[model samples]
Target: MLKEKLLVLVGPTAVGKTKLSLTLAERYDAEIISGDSMQVYRGMDIGTAKATTEERARVPHHMIDIHDPDYPFSVAEFQQRTEGLIRDINGRGKLPFIVGGTGLYIESVCYRFQFGQGGSDEAFRAEMQAYAEARGAEALHARLREVDPEMAEKLHPNDLRRVIRALEVHHLTGERLSEQLKGQKKQTPYELCIIGLTMDRALLYNRIEKRIDQMIEEGLVDEVRSLLNRGYGKDLVSMQGLGYKEIALFLEGRCTLDEAVELLKRNTRRFAKRQLSWFRHMQDIQWVDVTDMEKISDHLSEIHAIIAGKLTLDR
Candidate 1:
């Protein structure tokens, strides 16, 4: 049996995860380690919904502002770093509270899904990109289906990045991606209590749109401008996220601010839908209905009670 408890807080964008996480952490006497993909960048704050400095000070948070926008960080790297930190936190007699809405990142820890051996090959990837361009996405996707049909089913047909990475793993390992992930999950070494935050779809979308508006009011455009002036472009993996991509399109005159904002809202809504799809498959997840609570304390108390009970059962 594992020696400690690792609690995960997961949900979609603009679900008030930050607010709830701070309160939960205080109640459980835990430190927050972010599972967000975009919030790691130092200057990309407004778009990523990174915690404000004052809010971060209220509850010690980790894994935000740890990189420059120009620096690439991957899910595999996040898995490695988060595992080490979780071990350290447990060693110190503290619960590892992994909080954020990035479903894949949280799943990485819970499932211990290995990205694969070695690392990304830029040259091989360029060749594959050319192949996808010359041939068709289906051509490569067919290849993935033969090896990792399960993953292909979960991914969309037009999702080029995931398709390429799935194909790349096969090229590198000569082992099927599905088999690789299956092997990893079978041998996962930890016991986790995963908590999911859920709310009504309409409310979630409204919050997403309002959050985007708030970001713009707080100078999201200037944040993007600074990153570009420092030499990052939309092509980089880190910069290709929803908010940054639309903002870059606006900055480069490809679209009007209004058009970009509309696209951001639509894409973010779609992203939330995808997140719900992803988390719905997660095993042993205890979901807390956020809107059910009348006040913040009620929500925190609900979450705290669940976690406390789970930890006791773990012991």
Candidate 2:
């Protein structure tokens, strides 16, 4: 029994995964399954850097815009949905290509991570939320740092939902979230061809700043304002996403527009660094240095060869 073939493109934000993915999907007759966590939310197009309507029309895409801003989407749900999409695409004689920057989500699908059924304690979650609200997010994060430093390090203090969930998992199961992840098997049900794009750090950070500026110019602030006007609270996971969070602060008068933009750029740069760090720890990635924009065709050929050889693709 052979494993189903999966082609994955992963890299930090602003590393140009989208444009390259379009070309590869066209060439390989693949249907893309978005590996991005944020892109799953509707009405988050500008901030998430979603493929335009024109681009999406060029190739079939799945696992995007399936949820509202208030919906609570977990990594487990992402894995389940993506697995089904992969099977369906293969059934139709098309390759399944996953493209995005979300490390945990993509890695969960790639390695078939089985997150244990850690039942939630509603009271405990509420308590943690109250603690965050009263004592501030940093204080709540500090509590987690005492119990599960590794997990705390990975999560941002402002990501209160995940932080509370982590604390809840620990309280309910008496085991750290990081430990449970380590306990899971690292086996995959797919024959994976994972391509990672990379560039010089300074260059990548510059690109990230420029991209955020472009997002602002493209009405990201108004997009956040619209979601808020529709009654999506700022604390919703979707609202706390990269672009939305920063701009929401500005809209709420918590910061000036310039301050929000600068903070967004800085946070995004840190995020890209974290993304790269996470992907670096994963195994079996064929790295392509996409530092030279003029050599895109060469990079594409290089990636195509990797997929062909790894998955034994005849075409």
Candidate 3:
């Protein structure tokens, strides 16, 4: 029988999710379907923080390096791929683990939001995206609030894509995106246990800085340069990501190299803060504080018990 369970591992950036995910995969005999957006692109490794071959080989990982940097990717595509992966992995007598820090991607799977909604206002979406760039993400969200208060309440003012989408639904179909999600069939094919990992906010910030520094030392700039050399520019969806955007600014002489690095650090920290806010707002997720878990063994034991309890309940 297929083991229909989804073990979702989420946390803010730099909180060390990869190692824990690897350990959990081995422990649960699960296969991982990555929950990251940037990591899906090939030749974007160092900056995207894709796991080393050694790390990923030890635990089978899906959804990493699946696209070229020049290609476009979308949240809709992710949802479709996840639906297939869940079935394939379950058919193999293993559990499916969805792991990463991308809150929207996670929600796409967890809540199984319909990616095919027809209430798409192309003009409004274009306007909102431009507004976010010209004014700010908060300004776009303010526009959404005037149209869809319910969606505005849940989405962060800085979440550019969702804020635009919410406004688009209102302008196109004259219906709320929030209402669209309501009373709809959840597309999730698996029963799930959500795990949230965290550390002290200060400590998490330290780890993010250290990880970015390490990424640079490991040739992040060269990776971006290689992609650029191949003709991808800042306008590509892949290039719009955290690392690429800052590096592109530096290359464009909009900022000094040092300033670019500092901006990367600051922007990543803000992104992590946004990530934390998203995960924290989720009500049913069980959190494991990294500061409290002395060792992987201890952490694994607790997580194992949670999974075991789920199986027992099913029995």
Candidate 4:
């Protein structure tokens, strides 16, 4: 028997998820747990587009600003923490709502993925990092392709961390990471519901561009400057996120502000496309088109019916 229940709301970035999620949470008396990878870090509020303090005060939230900027938050750690939160919410007779665009984090918990403790080899990891540094990232990625082509195809050459992880997993287990995941009999420990939001590609891109303009006006560049001024270097993983990294280049005089803004908008649009592609291939998601709304009431009514169908609520 399942021990808890979970409601997941996911979509591409800047797709109005925050507003919609708040409404749903209030209606069901649910507490929100952020599923975003970047939102976990402190002092990253503006660049990460995290929920405002006022909004958070209105409804309880978890998993945001839980760590300093330099802390490394692995997916395994996220899974463990979120499971504990879900249990607590269920025990208290409140719904648990997981809301964000982080697909890997959400999927890991939904499928109850088991990332074993023995997959690390510090010496080997060091060796792989040194190899990439010496031979270039593409060379290291090619090495990964030689062993796990399936995993390699999904990863980009510039994503050295994940590429190194794929290689490390093979070295430690002597088996492909992709194969291990495929062979596992994946199961969910909760009664789960996943809702995905989407709209026309052109319309989504326009929203993304407008959101970037708004973020700039809201001082995203100043936010990045504040973090860097406090001595958070560009080398930290947190600094490498979308808006932070791009704006950092402008602050460094490596690019003009306009160029940086354009780059951010373009990269965000591509990121949104990739997000939609990932969700499209996932199973059991009730997708809602935000463009279909002539009235806010209509959209909420549709969402309410969908959630009511999936969840057993006392109200």
The collision pairs in model 4 are none
Which residue pairs show backbone clashes in model 1?
Answer: none
Q: Tell me which of candidates 1 and 3 scores higher on lDDT.
A: 3
Per-prediction TM-score, please?
Answer: 0.85, 0.96, 0.86, 0.90
Instruction: Point out the worst 10-residue segment of candidate 2 by lDDT.
Output: 150-159
lDDT of each: 0.78, 0.89, 0.79, 0.85
Give per-residue CA lDDT, model 4, range 151-189, as digits (tens): 776554545666788898899888897787566455777
Residues 169-194, model 3: lDDT tens digits: 67777888877766456555557788
- Tens digits of per-residue lDDT for model 1, 176-214: 665665566633356567889899888889999999999
Worst 10 residues of 3 by lDDT: 306-315
Compute the lDDT of residue 242 as modeled in candidate 3: 81
The 10-residue segment of model 4 with minimum total lDDT is 153-162
Quality of model 1 by C-alpha lDDT:
0.78
Model 3 whole-model lDDT (C-alpha atoms): 0.79
lDDT of 2 by residue, 104-186 (tens): 89989999997756887888888888888799888999999999998887776777888898898889889998888777777
